[model samples]
Target chain A: MSSALRIAAVAALLSLAAAPAAQAHRAWLLPGSTVLSGAEPWVTVDGAISNTLFYADHQPMRLDGLKAIGPDGTEVPLQNASTGKYRSTFDVKLAQPGTYKIVTATDMTMASYKIGGETKRWRGAAADVATAIPKDATDVQVSRNVRRIETFVTSGAPSTGALKPTGKGLELEPITHPNDLVASEKGRFRLLLDGKPAAGVEVEVVLGGVRYRAKGPELKIMTGGDGVFEVAWPEAGMYWIEAGVRGAPNGSAPAQNAAYIATVEVLPD
Target chain B: MRILKFSGLALAASGAAASPTVGQAADLTVSVEIPKLNVAEYHRPYVALWIEKPDQTAVRTLAVWYDTKLKANEGATWLKDMRTWWRRAGRSLNLPADGVSGPTKAPGRHVVSFSGGQLAGLAPGDYALSVEAAREVGGREVLRVPFSWPPRGAKTATATGSTELGAVSVTVKP
Candidate 1:
């Protein structure tokens, strides 16, 4: 084969490998300490997208979509925010004496279509869909992806003011305060999709230190009829939870797929 | 305090008379020991004591020892340090709950007594007493002692801590 053709073939294979499947690469935000006790303590958080939980061996999760919701349900700025090759680091000053929600959300649409016998793909925000594809494009397929990653850090007593569901995409309505989890007790949480109970959804609970263990300790739980699920922590450590669902396509709109991920720390009793 | 105690007894006597099924009233005494450590700084630990069913549902919060005197109720901010109690019962309670909330204590054995009125309405079943302590610039420890409610006889259960706490004992008198 010609060297140029060989190079083109290799590039094609690399692009195929780069296309990640749903749940292939996991994104997480791990806080240095979920529970704090000072008058005004600062909590550092690391963000990454890796195959292993909490391990920043892969790509960095961009901080552009990151936000910290203070105890008052208002937006708080992240300090010392920096993105390196493998991870993103930021600090949150706990000026308020309550729990804060650190979150990152991405909503986008991807479309593939054939124009004049050539297949092409375009990805951008949902509003750009009209301009992304040509008017004469045939066999056009489009889909929407919405992902949210979040964690909680408490400066003093954990308050629920910042934990109210936004009635947006998938979210966790914590029945048990996230920062107050202990190994000896069970933690309860509710799943909401667009502000409604997301029942009968499968939740993936994985312990964070999977790189050290021979087999990953992952627990599969299904949300009850009330969109509630209970997790009886096996030990004290960090845990990653994820749940996703896909909606059926409406008349002209693409199907919307939503995913939610959270990193929670559980203390030993 | 004496008048309050006398009125409490009067109320209990009247309530018991109104309901024969209300068995003999039982009193619970919890002694929590906050150990002293040789360190550069020593801050009194925030402690919480509560009763839980076998399923770990908090039935009643006996006491919450914290910095109740901070300006503008700032001390209540650190109450999450006692994490288990905060999730189970502390978050719902208003601070300085009459007899349930108080200031932090020094390093020593502090005894807290709860009358039948305090532990009233607990169905006869297996229960556990949990004492959790957290210290600033230090560590956290939680100790639990299992016991049954509506004591068939006088019972005593104890737990020991290593870092943030010392010996903790719960006794019930029939």
Candidate 2:
């Protein structure tokens, strides 16, 4: 073959080889182990970059513009803790008690990509009546008032059995408030038939193997009731989802129910 | 003051319940299609399928079809765009699923099936069957279909979404 013909053949081969590499950039956030956990809760967004064939001129694949938010709309900062990894921690010290959420976004290849996960919020209160220890004793004690103490338990479901009486034999009473109520993770859900407020509805919100149950209150409220139903979740992690509905067999609507679901992240205390 | 008290309550409340049923392996079929890339003529995409609750929680990982023939690394980078699946299930598992094929699917259409009993144990409720496709260099698209399993019935349902997939039909074969 002539020299000119050989040059032409080499050019063709080079173009063919680069064809696949020239295609559009495929970028997605890989948060390793998806399940974020800890006693003092936080999240580690770690994952590999797959098929990320970048242009020769551009930098190698890296997580750009990533952020996480807690359930109360607090921003969790992603710290550059190591190579090819990003992390964010939220302390409930300043975060409001409710379902927290984390939104992660990345700007790469001239486009911005985003996704998020939520964690259940369980903010318990220590309002029980306290009893003083011996004058020199360092132990502080409280009388367990059931109603007052119940307010701190996530979901306040009887199954939890986490509620306890104080040394003064004070029982913790359960109160109705939208403090930490996560919806049921079950697929199909229904509310009570009594047209009154949706109380006694069993809601089981499960993420991974963890389950949090929130039961509706017996208090009656209008269809568009403004009352809040809360349940305290056990763990502080990423993304908590609750699913359920309201209706009444005791009212005009029979077999009628509505479904409500929400996602949020629970920050650590 | 309120913060201090609430923290105490939060600690007591973290009781988690039992595991949701890992659906029994019921005979089922899943089809994934990829149109020939307008250019590179690259190999098929590596697709992943899993189940997510209507509430958007990862339930289980059903299948991940990728380019096993080449020993190519199925990078975890692009797994996030498989949004519905990632948040619901994928993020929970360790990498390189053993005993499963990982070769990318060729552009076109592919039909895959699983044995019966896979659908069992999925609590009777609403669920979204999700499938995601990732090309080595091309863009990624995920198609999800909504479905429900009644208390005692074996049936089939079909739904469609805009993405690399054409049509997805899920049948519960008892």
Candidate 3:
């Protein structure tokens, strides 16, 4: 009987250690920074995970008691369900008219892939933690959401000082809706330079830590003789625009020599 | 057994003495710039730079743009976008970089340089230097520049890139 009790005590200790620790669930609370209208909104769930203990895409994990706190400090309950992986979706009703905060949790592991045949490890806890969602959300900030960017391009022979280091160059504009974003719509930008029409100049629009590249023609625009052009917004979010010719001497490679402008902010209407 | 152990130690010491110290410790000035847009302004880009060998093997991580200013953990998610630098150097890092942090650079001309003494332990050989930039909402471009170091003396090479960088110049001095 004494031996039996000893065995039971050891087993209990083992179970305690194996059980999830207090902060092990620190990464779970999902944060939804973006929500689009006219479609189901998916809240993004992400956090730093330790590959040493947990595994990726661990299912059977669920987040309960989700609520959004408005900028005025009002608690708004959100309806949600885990779709799979590191994502969750909710109906549009949960998104209030103002900025909000989201709190939830998930159990996932961090894993590292071999780069050039080396195995690296990411160290962190396995349990989910609660994270707040910011009110001012962008497409990139939302999990699995995409934004649209539109531009108008025009092309014409450079006049005396046009296209020179100092000249009246181009104008890129961004349009967004209060609605959410779509993935395929990301990475689209526009270009317009000189007084004559400069159509089809290669332009790139980058945002939310992702890059989307497309030719000016695909962006759709009609150029006037005055070098004024336009394209539709392919993605929505805060964005930075760059427009230039592919073949230039600024860098050894033509792609390397292309010049870039400045960053721009696009807010949804 | 003792005799064999002694022989092994002797060989190791001799090999160590004969090895040339070529990984010179060097300092590099780094900068990043993302083009501007009017449609939807993009946030600053998150850029990473590192040194690698000719075969595309990683030697060291020079910089990374990971921080809280952008969003909660957005910097960590985008680390993979800087593919060249990530594969060559970043994937091997055990922790966030110690010195480099923050969002992308504004649109402007920027410059970075390195020296020979900074590469204190490298071997003298033909080396290819590569710099890669990736913008959050912008495209990615990798610029490769080749340089060779003779055991002694300071050698320099300059390489430039397009897109996200107004200009990326590298100066190496012994």
lDDT of 3 at A224: 40
**Model 2: per-residue Cα lDDT over B10-128, one tens digit each:** 43243222222233333556665566556655646667777788766656677777544433342444444354454445545554555233656666667766542334345667876
Candidates 1 and 3: which is better by DockQ? 1
Residue A15 CA displacement from its true place in model 3, Å: 52
After aligning candidate 3 to the native by TM-score, how far in Å is the CA of A93 from where it should be? 24
Error of 1 at B102 (Å): 9.8
DockQ of each: 0.23, 0.02, 0.01
TM-scores of the models, in the order given: 0.71, 0.34, 0.34
Tens-digit per-residue lDDT, A138-249, candidate 2: 2221211111101121111112122211222112122322222233321221222222344444433323222233432212222213122444444543332322342234
- Model 1 DockQ (Cα-based): 0.23
Candidate with top TM-score is 1
Which parts of model 1 have CA positions greater than 4 angstroms off?
A1-22, A224-226, A247-251, B1-82, B85-141, B144-174
Q: Report the lDDT tens digits of candidate 1 across residue range A1-269.
A: 99999989987875674342435678899999898764677899999998777899899989997999999999999999999999999999999878999999889787888899987888899999988899999988788888889999987568988888888889999999998888988999999998899999999999988888997678999999999999988888999999999887787899888899999999875
Least lDDT summed over 10 consecutive residues: which range in candidate 2 chain A? A148-157
Q: For residues B111-170, what per-residue lDDT tens digits would candidate 1 score against the true structure?
A: 987765666666788899999998999888889898888777889999999899899998
Model 3 preserves the real interface contacts to a fraction of 0.00
